[model samples]
Target: MAKLLEIRWHGRAGQGAKTAALVLAEAAISAGRYAQAFPEYGPERMGAPMQAFNRISDEPITVHSHVTNPSIVVILDPTLIAATNVKAGVPADGIYLVNTTMGPCEMRKRLGLTDSPAKVYTLDATQISMDTIGRAMPNTPMMGALVGATGLLELDQLIADTREKLGRKLRPEIVEKNIEAIRRAFQEVAS
Candidate 1:
């Protein structure tokens, strides 16, 4: 049977959570995996918490539906924890990736997680993006961290996919800088 992986993203409207899901799906597809990416938008307000979903399988995905039980949960905005129940559908053995200055223990505490044994990794991807990409857009960098955490795709594959997806819309300098941000996040924040 082909392996299936689902990812759920939780974040505020302007935090690039939807873009992260789309970019990750594109990268997975570029790596020859079957991938589906879509967002669940509620109130179209900037600070409102929203969600996006992705499903990847070695075989073609036939279910074009929202993820109910995700193998991985990515939180783009830490503040969403106050407004959303992000950890509800997460599997016990799955991974949780969050963008925050708080470490894993602090995040777990903040999430009110006590009995769950899910592995959690926290990164200051916002700061990383600000310092490297000169913007708070963390979609690509968080994607890099996901790749490193899951080993779902290779570094070259992500770089190539990123170059293919973003290189045309951005100047060469911007493209290179984003690529560098991805690499740095992969190495630094992917624990």
Candidate 2:
């Protein structure tokens, strides 16, 4: 059977969770994999909580639905950790990639999952974004962390795809900064 990887992203309306999911799907496709990316929005306002889902597999995917049991969960906004049940459908062996200044051990303690089987990883994605992209938007950085945590796609492929897709709409400098954010996050994520 082909292995299917399900990912769920949680963030606010303006944080680019949807964009990150789309980019990952695109990168996966570029790497000759089958993938799907979609988003669920609530209230349709900036800062409003939302979700994005991705399914990547070696073979074609037939199911098109929300990921209730995600093998990987990416949290772009740390505040949402408390506001939402971030672990609702995550399995014991699931991996969590969170954007915060806290390290993985601290994150485990705060989430009350120190003894759980789930693996917690964290990076200061917000800081990385601010330093590289000049903004606090952590979506791109979190994407890097996702790749690092899961190894579902090649890091170089993700950077190339991101530049190609985002360059069409953004300035060259912004694109470079975003790529840098991704690279930094990929290397900095701690378990």
Candidate 3:
């Protein structure tokens, strides 16, 4: 059987974790892969801890449980590293993609991954979003960084899906700003 790629996203409720997962799954499906994206929410309030998951495979996915062993784990907020066991359920060689100003080596130390085989990647997605969208929403930029790091989906395909998804609710300029954020973060992610 083919190995399905599982991704787990961690962030607060107001962040764009859910949106990022959904967008990635949409883009993968558009690329002719089978994909699933879903969110797990706690209490109904902003700032609450939340999670979103994605499973992508060439063949159909069969597992329906929460992603306990994600091959890729994305942390939308660096603070979660201290506040929660962001490393839970990850394999020794799993990828940790975090949104932060720290360098990958420093982040690896902070995460106690100095001797681990896991790859650590970091980017200031908040700064990227603020610079591009005039807001601190890190979802789009983190998604862009994820694609840039993993090449799970083509960059253009992800952007096109993001544009089509956000265009329904935001102004043309705002949507363009988000696209710019995605593109910029794709270039700026540090592994």
Candidate 4:
């Protein structure tokens, strides 16, 4: 049986939280896994906080339940940590990919975080996105951190899948920039 991976995304509407989930699911499927992606909508307005989820496994996923015990929790917005219980329902050893420049120690101080068992990979995806894509939307760069933090998929494959998934939504130049961002993030993980 293939290992299962559940991911929960916390971000505002229009920030590509849903897109991120879909892209990840698609990538997994392309890699010969069963995957599903969906989002929970609320208030239904841009900038309103929302959640998206993904499930991937070798065996066919039969469960239709919302993810309450995600293996990976991605925080696309740093503010969501304060605004919502972003850590809710995560396993003690769950991995967190947070978009921030703050080091783990500094992040703990800035967020006033009490010690938690979950491991975290923090990156300035906001800055990386702005520099790479010329926008503050961090979905693509956040994918880089995800790849870096966890060797869930091949970095090149992920970037290729992402480009294919986002091709029409972004210009060719932007796509190239995003590829560069992912490369940088992959190197960041190695160094």
How many pairs collide in each candidate, listed in order? 0, 0, 0, 0
Residue-level lDDT tens digits of model 3 in 2-102: 36999999999899899999999999999999999999966758887889999999998878888888889999998888888888989999999999999
Candidate 4: tens digits of C-alpha lDDT, residues 1-191:
33778999999998889998998888888888899999997778988999999998988999999999998888899888888988788887787788877776666555545486667778887887788778888887787778788878788778879899889787888889988877776655321
In TM-score terms, candidate 3 sits at: 0.97
The per-model lDDT (C-alpha) reads: 0.83, 0.91, 0.92, 0.82
Off by over 4 Å in 3: none
Error of 1 at 132 (Å): 0.6
TM-scores for all predictions? 0.92, 0.97, 0.97, 0.91
Tens-place lDDT per residue, model 2, 167-190, is 988999999999999999899989
Clashing pairs in 4: none
Kindly state the number of residue pairs that clash in model 4: 0
The candidate that wins on lDDT is 3
Residue-wise lDDT of candidate 1 within 32-79, one digit each (tens)?
889999999676898788899999899988997679999899988888
Pick the winner on TM-score between candidates 3 and 4: 3
Cα displacement (angstroms), candidate 2, residue 38, comes to: 0.2
Error of 4 at 154 (Å): 0.6
